[model samples]
Structures are given as C-alpha cells and as structure tokens.
Target: MDPTLAIPLLGGLSPAAFMRRHWQKKPCLIRQAIPGVKPPLSRTELFALAERDDVETRLMLQRQGAWELRHGPFTRRQIPALNQPGWTLLIQGLDLQVPAAHALLQQFRFVPEARLDDLMISYASDGGGVGAHLDSYDVFLLQVSGRRRWRVGPVKDATLVPDMPVKLLANFEPTEEWVLEPGDMLYLPPRWGHDGVAEGPDCMTCSIGFRTPTPTEMAREVLQRMIDALEAPEKEPHYRDPAQTATATPGLIPEALQTFTQKAVIAALNDSRSLACALGETLTEPKAIVWFEGGEALAPGQGLRLDMRSKMMYDADHVFINGESFRAAGRDARLMRQLADQRALSAQECAGLSPGARELVEEWALSGWMHGV
Candidate 1:
C-alpha cells in the first residue's frame, strides 16, 4: 500500500495521513470500508470452528442483568438459538486458521507486522454483547454481518465490576455512538472504552487487533530469547571464597559472586548482533497453539510461499522465521528479507538464492515453514 494513496479503508485518508491524524490517537468510523463484504465464514462454518478443540473460543450471555461467560469446544446445543437474545460467540486468531481471515488482516499492513496481531471474530445473537470494556491494544472492528450499535469513548474511570468473569466497566461514559452495518468499520486506539451490542440476529464483527507490549514486557521477552545467544556459563569458574574471613552473617550473598553475575550479564548484553538476532527471533515466534503440517522439499521449478502459520521477520544481519534465526548477508539477505516482507518469492527469485541458502529453504519446506507455490 502506498503511503500517499487515498483509500476508503481509512475514510479516504492516505496511509501516511491516517497514521499521522488518527492512528493511536482517536476513534475513526468508516462507512462501507469494505463495500458488499461477505463474512469470512458462514454461521455454520463459524459454529463448526468453535467446536474444534484446537481453536480458542468463548460463549457469553447477558441474561436477567447478569453476564455469563463460557469456554468452548461447544456442542451445537450449547449455542443459543438464532432467534435468541443476548448471547455471543468469540473465536480468537481466525487469521491463524483461515485464509480469508488472513487476507483481511493483510489489508492493515500499513502498520508494521511486528505490531500486528490477529483477527478475532465475534458472532452474536440479537441484543448480545460482552459488555463495555477497555482494551490495552489498538483495534479495528469491521462489521461483516447484520448490524451492531457501538458506544465508544476515552476511559476516565477504569473501575470494573468486582469478581466478574470478564471485565465490565462500572462507569462507562460514551461520547460517541454509531450503528455499524455490514461493511462498516471502526478503529479505536489503545485503552479506549467501547461496547457493541448486536442490533439484530447473526451479527458478526472482525477485530484486527495490534499488540502493544510495554517496555517491561518487551524486555522480559527479549531477555528470555537473548539467553540463547549468551556464552556457556559452564566455562566460568564456580563460586569460591578461598580467602574468606569468617563472618556471622552466613546468609548474605558474597559481593564477589554478585560481581561475577553482573559481569556475565554485561558481556552477553554487549553482543549487539546477537541482541538483534534474539529480538527478531522473539518477534517472529509463532503462538503456542500454531502448528504446521510437514511436507517434502521444494521441487526444482516451484516458487515458495510462507505457510499461514509461519511468522517471518528480519533485521540488519539476520532473518528469523518460526522462532528460528539465521545470519543473512548480501544477495541472500536481500532475497530472504523480500520473502519475509512479501510472504512469497517467485521461481526466478528462488533461483537467485545461494546454494547454502537454497538448501536451508528446502529444509524449511520439508519442515512446513514454507511450501512450494
């Protein structure tokens, strides 16, 4: 997508202008963002997916002024009747499981893939909702079926109802409200309080959410992955106080040992290339629930495309995919980064790979990270 190209998806704002004016700052509603869009999965298909043990799903209801929440692998009987009111089904990570969902997610790639998370579908019966709540991440909610009335605003009081199964705002004050019809979309920045209730039956909304890991959260993840880059601690001497003076405080940690630990950590942190590789690997790591099917190596004439389940990213000197990192340079680096950016490479591009890189890609194909196209 061109940064300067005006698009209906952002209410006629160019990608650059949208990012500058609205992204992470305020709410945006686009009428018919996707004109005449069909639901990614039909009602029956969504229900079937909800029944799969491998898929993450939830059922919620608002009955008699009480909210109910349930996890699924649901039987058809577990679902509310179509004509019923105040019930919703949520299926998480639809992009990880369905091609159509993945395609829908790609439309928002004007935002970097590192921040892009997954598409989640909410299917609701008449009058249904999960209740007013605030989210820590940004989201684009696109109505795909029926209609939903949305009430959204900046959160002033973050108080929640005590001991509830899900977070429900106790003092939600909506400054803006809209009824989103099929093909309509709304964008909300992080921590904005919002609620949506189905206007009628068969309401479905696709949420394209973005991850916003805090500094501490990101540090924890990067440090854990960075451990793989650290030098072997076995090479360091065991703690010894050969010349120690007898002290009454035996429980106290020795200053020498603390110095040794600090030195070891500092040495590890000094390896900038390793640090970059670790960060890339961490960012590209697939979710625990994601699994890929094994396949044979790529054939001679075939192009290559990443599996939907695979996450690929790159930094200055490394290419990372599916939690594994590799050093990349020159022509190999250029093409590998291209593959990560475009999610596929043509036969000509594949032919340009160095013999070592080609063999590595073949191994990835055999492991089902990417497949012959």
Candidate 2:
C-alpha cells in the first residue's frame, strides 16, 4: 500500500500521517472502517468454534456485581441462554481458523507483520463487559455488529482487583467515551485504559492486537535460539593451567580461566549472522497450539501461497518460516524475500528459483507450510 494514500480505515489519514500522528501516541476513532461491516461469524458459529478443543475461548459474566470467568471447549449446554444478560464469550485467533476473519485482518497489513498478532472476537449480551483493563500491546477494536459503548483514557494506576481471574482495573477513570455502532472502530495504544459494554444482546467486537515483546522476553527467546544453533564438535577443549604453581588458597579463582570464559562468551555473542537468523526465526515462530495438516507437494507449474498457520519472514541474509531458518542468497534469495513480503509467488516467480530452492519449497508444500495457488 502507498504510505501517502488516504485510507477510510484510518479516518481519512494516510498511513504515513496516521503512523506519525496517532499510532502509539493517541486514539483515532473511525466512523466506518468498513461501511455496513458484518460480523465474520454469526453468534451460533462463534459458539461452535468455542466448543473445539483447539480453539482458545473465554467466558465471562458479572452477576450482582460479582465476576466469574471460565476457559472453554464449553458445551452448547454450558453456554448461557441468549436471553440471559451480563455474559460475554471471547474467541481468540479467529484469523487462523476463519477465512473471512483472515481476509478482514489482511487490511491492516500497513503495520509490519512482525508486530501483527491475531484477531479476537468478543460476543457480549446486554450489559455484559470484561471490565476496565490495560493491554500491554496496541489494539484496534472494531464493532462489527450491534452496538457497544466504550470508555477509554490514559492509565493513572496499574492496580487490579484482587482475587479476580481477569485483569480488571480497580479504579477506571474514563476521559473519553463513545457509543460504537456497526462499522465503527477505535484504536488504543499500549497501557491505555479502556472498557467496553454491550449496549444490547448480539453485540460483536473484533480486536486486532499487535505484539509488543519486552526486551527481556525477546532476549530470552533470541538467546535460546542462538544457543541452540551452535554446532558442537565431537571433541571439546578442556581448560588447563598446567604451568600454574600450587596456590596456598585453592578457593581463590584463577585469572586465566575467567579470561577464557569471557572470551568464549564474547565469541558466541559476536556471530552477527547467527544473531540475525535467531531473531528472524524467533519472530516467525508459530503459536504453541498451532499445527498444520499435510498436503500434496507443489507441482512445477503451480503458484504457491503460505498456509494460514504458517509464519514467514526474511532478513538480509536469511529466510525464516515456522521456527526454522535457512541462509538464502542470489536469485533464489530475492524470490524468497518476495514470497515473504507478498505471501505468495506466481508460477513464473517459482520457476525463477534455483533447483535447491525449488526442492525446499516443494518440501514446504508437502509439510503443509504452503499450498499451490
């Protein structure tokens, strides 16, 4: 997408303008991100998804000012009657399972895929809400059906209600409030306090969230990947200090060993290529619960598109997909990067890849990482 092109989804602001003015800086409420937008799934369909063991679902209700929360694979019988108020059901990762949801989410590609997370749908009955809370990542809340009222503001205190299963702000102070009808959307930055309550039954909201891994969390994953990539030799070198005389205090640490240890760590950390590979692979890693079904291998003339469950990314010298990394260069490297960017490659583009790269892609198709298009 052209950065300077004005988009209706961004409230008439071009992506460039929106990124400069509102992204992570403040909120922007778009009246009709998608005019006449309909929910990707009906209430019945959403409830059925919640019944699947592979789906991540949550049920929340407030009765007499007391809150209750439950994890799901819930039975239809377990769900409250439609007439019942004060209840909400949330289905996570809709884009991974639903074609319509995935297509809807594709519109937000202006944001880099590295930061992009999944789309979650929240269905709420009259007076239902999850309570006010702060999210650590940016979120775009789109009201797809029915009406909901949102109260949003900056977080003054990070305190949560004690003994609550869900994070509920103990004291929510709203400075901006709006009633969102179908097609309305709201954007909130990280740590911005917000709450939404269904105006009536059948209310459905879709949340597009972005991942914001903390430095320590990123370090742990990247470091682990880097360490795992080390190729250990069959024989290991042992530290020796045969020239040293016997010390009166054996407890004293040896300077030579400390220097060796430092050198070893520095050597490990200095592999810039390894570090880049580790980061790319880490970013493209799929969710723990995600798995793909095996399919036929890509034929010579067929184009290819990534499986919805597949995560693909590329760095300067490497391409990463589903937690695995491969060094890529030359013509094949350029085509692989194109696949990562476009999420698909034409038959002509696939034909351009070298023999080794073509074989690798065929393997991906057989493994269900990509499909013939």
Off by over 4 Å in 1: 233-243, 246-248
Roughly what TM-score does model 2 have, to 2 decimal places?
A: 0.96
Error of 2 at 40 (Å): 1.4
**Residue range 1-373, candidate 2, lDDT tens digits:** 7889999988898999989998899998999988989899988899899999999999998999789999999999999988899999999999999989988987898889999989999999999889999999999999999999999999898899999888899998999999999999999999999999999889999999999999999999999999999875699798898988989999988999899899888888898998998999899998987998888988769999988888898888899999999999999999999898778999999989899999999999999999998
Cα lDDT tens digits, model 1, 136-213, are: 999999999999999999999999998889999999999999999999999999999999999989999999999999
Clashing pairs in 1: none
C-alpha lDDT of residue 351 in model 2: 89
Backbone clash total, candidate 1: 0
Residue-level error in angstroms, candidate 2, position 58? 0.9
lDDT of 1 at 42: 90
Candidate 1: worst-modelled 10 consecutive residues by lDDT: 228-237
> For every model shown, what is its TM-score relative to the native structure?
0.96, 0.96
Give the Cα lDDT of each candidate. Answer: 0.92, 0.92
